[model samples]
Target: MQNFFPAQYSTLSAAALKDYLIKVYQLDPSTTCRLLIRNVSDTYILENQTQKYIFKIYRDAHRKCDEIEAELELLNILKAEGNSVSYPITDVAGKQIQQFNAIEGIRNGVLFSFAEGKVILDLDSAHLTQLGRDIAKLHQTTSSLKLNNPRPVFSFETTLFEPLKDLKPHFSEMIEEYEYLSNIADKVVKKFEEFDTSKFNYGYCHYDFFPKNFHFDEAGKITFFDFDFAGQGYLINDLMSFLNHYFFHQLNNLISREQAEKDFNTFINAYQQVRPLTDDELKAIPYLGITFHIFFLKFFYDNYDDWSNAFLTPRYTKHRVTLIKKWEEMYCNF
Candidate 1:
């Protein structure tokens, strides 16, 4: 047999995955599997007559085995606590993660119970309130426990300073934009110093709470998924991410500033009904929001080659910086 050429990234065949999953998971022979997304990780949808599941294959560069274990551990805890989260499924051999030897190297894959329902972009008052309560309940668990394996930590060093350093080269042509990010990062750090962060609720945050990561069932129950960015951080990071939903809505003219504030406050009030948040913590959200944008900007730059080659251009970088400026202007006082 001819030696296979070395590869950086390889797309696993859906047919091969379907057959393997059927045997490992002991699924019905008639079960079908199809690729759902091919981003930083590849997502496959597997379905039989009565059941459906999401099988995700992780890229070694994006998520190491230990990090993947941590994510699965987090999900298992969430599921056990009765939180509505899509969780990993164990195979007949009691293995939650399957090892695949692809052209590049050994890749890890997991089967997740499919989150039932659809994304509701135009969330109503009840939807927002339920979402808030459920998220706070989830925090009740995530905030209290520690996982055996390690995941990312969203600190000023990781989210702000390190990203700035890593992104310096990408912004070589956009020195002004780079300076803006650096200055704002400094401001954010100083702003945090003004607050009594001792009272901030510390825990693992979803980090990407945009509506798309969650689904609303026919009865309005919400199930959150996509824990790829879940990490150790202030619990408020989840609230900040959900707030970004309204930020973009107002930015796109889908909703007025007045309505956006009203809607987000609905969520905040509901969250507080479940778990209390200090005024200082609420005040610090905008600054943390600044870090959120900068962190993702660096993510795009770093993963561009593997994730979004077409989307990460100089123009996109400048546009992202412009959006960050707008976010600061809209929310931050300093």
Candidate 2:
């Protein structure tokens, strides 16, 4: 891994930044700027002079600059169709991604048109239903574009299993739980693979559609950001990520089986109303949803070694156990 550039401090001086803006984006020097949140790769959010352009600086150069550029291009395509996506701003010559030299290493950056809405986590049933509709619209829009980007798969294999492979020895203490989830992940892949996924006509999708990455305005309209994980996949896989978070993870209590079924069906039905699901997709839902729950539970649980700095609570762990048992009883006929 390359050394991380310090994102906490702005490497560009105020004067230097102003000059760069003029060269890259043709902006004024007296722009007011404020810091937003920092991401894993140390991307910094710098509001340009007009308050319209938000620059995303990738502190790490080797981590697929081309992929990020492609993601921005996809967003631009979706936004042009009036799909409510965050669009990237271009250089002075109107290029989306700008390659620059930095001390930590060679890195890339891109500017985006600031999205207007706020990140909404707390929502009522109506709002949840709206989210379903918006996501369906997003998937539909991407499908129409037919843009293909061959990125890494975001299933249990890539996101969870691969990252945790080295930590398997550390998982010996929790061998029972680890092995159980490992087997479950394998079963899910096998079951889903049993059918021809291509038969369902895989399309481009925002693979990670969690609430934090979404925005909703005062008028009940929703928009999305963070297309970093956007790629080709079965549409239901995206649905599973959203439903798993809502039904199992987000709620405060052990979600009652009845409520779980209700919430799941509500979301699925609302989505299908806008963009219908195929028969194979409907059959795969129960397993895929449960698999998502288990995958994230173990994924979070396996990160306990870093728990010292982590704010993860005991309640979170208990909820995973609860979810696992409930999924087993509901799906496996326990």
Give the alpha-carbon lDDT of every model: 0.94, 0.63
Give the top-scoring candidate (lDDT): 1
Candidate 1, lDDT over the whole model: 0.94
Candidate 2 residue-wise lDDT, 157-224, digit = tens: 66446644743664566676557666766677778775566666466767667877777878877777
Instruction: Give the per-residue lDDT digits (tens) of candidate 1, residues 18-58.
Output: 99999999999999999999999999999989999999999
Q: List the residue pairs that clash in candidate 1.
A: none
- Model 2, position 326, has a per-residue lDDT of 67
TM-score of each: 0.98, 0.75
In candidate 1 the C-alpha lDDT for residue 254 amounts to 95
User: 235 in model 2: Cα distance from truth in Å?
Assistant: 1.2
